[model samples]
Target: MESSTQLVILAGLVIGLIYGAVGLLSGFCLMSSMRGWLAQGDGRLVRTYALAMAVAIAASQLLAGSGMADLGKSIYLQQSFSVPVLFLGGLLFGYGMVLSNGCGSRALVLLGRGNLRSFVVVIVLAIAAQMTLKGLIAPARIALVQASQITVNANSLPSLLAAFGAAEATSRALATSAIVVALILFAFAHPSFRRSPGQVAAGVIVGLLVTGGWFVTGFLGADEFNPVPVTSLTFVAPIADSLQYAMLSTGLTPNFGVATVAGVFAGSLITALATRRFQLEGYSSPRHMLRSAGGAALMGVGGVMAFGCSIGQGLTGLSTLALGSFVAVAGILLGTAAGLRGSLRVQPLAVA
Candidate 1:
């Protein structure tokens, strides 16, 4: 193994540990957060997510401004941004998360805690993601992406702001900082939320970890001769890739995504065990299993089409200031709202 690959993998594991720890500690699940806001009128969790995004955008943009990283090369910054596909993907992913009771990252955290239901979810999600990415659903996905994509000279938010008359440097700083400030204020505006130090810490730490993911892949792991793909944390393709690695270890080497995914499970397991929260769990009935499986399948397909999962687009992709990230996130939120209360709400699953 090359020294650089080893370093990347090690870095990925450390970052994953931090992210997973924060996630488990704070109950960091996008699906739950959104549902909390829309269905329960509880905004604390949503605020946590906002805090995470704010930290990610500010820190990531700073790295780019310092010339330490090139976020422009990320998949989120593609010249041709697909609108319809992202919307459809978000819708599917949002509703699926509701049905499964969690998002991809949340599922990983749960799996580490001995939740057999999460294990099933992880497996089904991976298989479904693989199908959408390169298997049975690939052709249709490609067609949808190709048909819905729009070519832009600059598809990123900062660039668009600059185009609208802000100076490039000012635009980047203003665009990024404004969102961060608003999120920070929103997160702390409530006295109740302000009192929850653990939740606050989780948001900040998770957000920084997004920046950390970018640094590991874009800066520390950069190799001009054998350049790794410029990316940060995301779970869609990585889940599928992780499953593939497990089955095809003899022929394949681990990448940042796979290592990070593996690390999430490991980190969560360690945390769960240490905290004495490691209890084995599974579905209560066949119907519960079926709903979860169906949800996992939708998430797999939707995540691929949207090009990211909640943390993938919500934080990692948004870190790049890409317009598509904004769009996809909006779609995800809309879909989540629907599933939580609007019209697509699934019945509650029985707890085992």
Candidate 2:
């Protein structure tokens, strides 16, 4: 590979390491946060999540505004996207996250702590994601997207504002300010969340990490001759790609995503070991195993269709202010709500 590619890969690994450690230490899972807020009547974790979103938006937009990274290059900024497909995908992924008790990133962190059940989740999720991305499910996914996708004049929030009347910089600033302010207000409104400094730091660090991923791929990896993909931290496709690379190293070349995926597992493992938190764990029963497997499959398929997982669309994608990301995120929140409240809520499973 090129020298720039190596640097990008190394950066990806570092970013993943930090992410894994922070996620494990802070219990940074969207499903868990939602469950805590809606079901358990605790909003601290969700507040942390909101802060992370606020930071990600502020930092990412700054990078883009400074011409350091082109957010336009990312998949989330596509001119044409399917509202139905993306929303449906988000709903599936969110509900699956509830069923599985976590998202892909959380599973990786838990697996690092010797959760054998997460191992199953990781493997099954990877396989299912791969199938959706390029295997048997790809054709159907592609057909659906092609059929339902709609073209829009403005792909991102800033662009939408620019189209109306504002200059590019003004539009970006306005949009970013609106979102960042709202998120910050939500995050800091609760005294309980404000008191949790560790959670606050995790949110800031994770947000910065998302920006770091963009810097690595969009700036550090930028080469006229051998250009690397302008992307950042997202686990769905990367987890699948990591699995494929592990099995087919002879033919595949490592990229930012795969390297990050490996680093997350390794970093979480090290943290768990150092903290004496590592302990082997598995499914409670066959029924539990089945539920987990089914959830994994749904996450894989849904994540692919939505073009990201929780961390993917919720944080990284939203950082770009993409319209589709908003749609997908809305779906994810609604889906999570469905699983957390009302008649559709998923009840706690009984131990076997």
Candidate 3:
């Protein structure tokens, strides 16, 4: 294997392990967070997410400031910002997260803990994602993006600022600093969040893991002969890639995303065993399974369209300060709110 490939695999494994371990330990579920905040008035998990976003934005911008990573080259920073697709996708994903009571990453962690239902979720999600990406639904997806996307000269916040006469470097710094400060204030505004060390740690570690992924792909894995796509953690495409790898190991080689996906599973399984959190679980009935399956399918398709899942768009994409990320996040929040409190809300199991 080439050195670049080896580095990518190694970095991906390290980051993935940390993500799994931290996620498992912290119970970091974005779906749960929103549900808790909306349904029960519990804000700890929501605050945790805010902290993670703040840290990711700050750390990622610092990495860019130091000239180590070119985040602008990432897919999220594309000039053709898709609006309608992202809005629709985010809506689907958020609603699905509520239905399934978890997102892709959460499903992985739950699977590690022996949730057979998550196995179904993973498979369905992967297949649905694959279909949207390159299989049956590709044509429609392509049409949607092509029709809805609007191209800008510069899609990043800093570049947009520069277009308004701000110096590029100054704009970048100011943007990063301002966003980080605002997020931190919001995250820490609640006294309960400041008191929860585990939640705080979860936010910090997960955010840094995202930055680490960027460094690996954009910096260490940067090769003149074969430059890796500048990317960080995202679950949609990676899950599909992992499924393809499982069936075509001889013809295909594992990349950072695949390795990261595998590592998360392994890391979470190991942690669950070591910490005595391992337990077997399954659906309450066929109806439950059907609901979960439907949710998974929506999530898979939506994630592909939006170019990310909750964590993918929420943290990794948002880290880019891309205008589209903001739009996507808003859609997700709106969809989640609808699911949690509106007519579309999916109720929990009635008697199980």
Rank candidates, lDDT, best first: 2, 3, 1
Q: Which model is ahead, 2 or 3, in terms of TM-score? A: 2
lDDT per residue as tens, model 3, 213-270: 9999999888989888889998989999999999999999889999899888888999
Candidate 1 overall Cα lDDT vs. reference?
A: 0.89
TM-score of every model? 0.98, 0.99, 0.98
**Model 2, span 1-352: residue lDDT tens:** 8999999999999998999899889999899999999999999999989999999999999999999999899999999999999999999999888888899999999999999989988999999999999999999999999999999999999999999999999999999999999999999999999999999999999999999999999999889899898999899999999999999999999999999998899889999999999988877889898998888999999999999999999999999999999989988888888987888888788643
- Candidate 1 C-alpha error for residue 294, in Å: 0.6
Flag clash pairs in model 1. none
lDDT digits (tens) for residues 1-352 of candidate 1 = 6677788889988888877777787899999898788778888999999999999999999999998889988889988978989988988998898989999999999888889999999999999999998899999999888887899987887899888888988989988988889988999997778989888988888998899988888898788876777788898789899999999999998999998998899999999999999999988999999999999999999999888999999999898989888888888888787888855677676597
Between the candidate structures 1 and 3, which one is better when assessed by lDDT?
Answer: 3
Give the C-alpha miss distance for residue 191 in model 3, angstroms.
Answer: 1.2
Q: Which stretches of candidate 3 lie over 4 Å from their true place?
A: 350-352
lDDT of each prediction vs. the true structure?
Answer: 0.89, 0.93, 0.90
**What would the TM-score be for candidate 1 when compared with the true structure?**
0.98
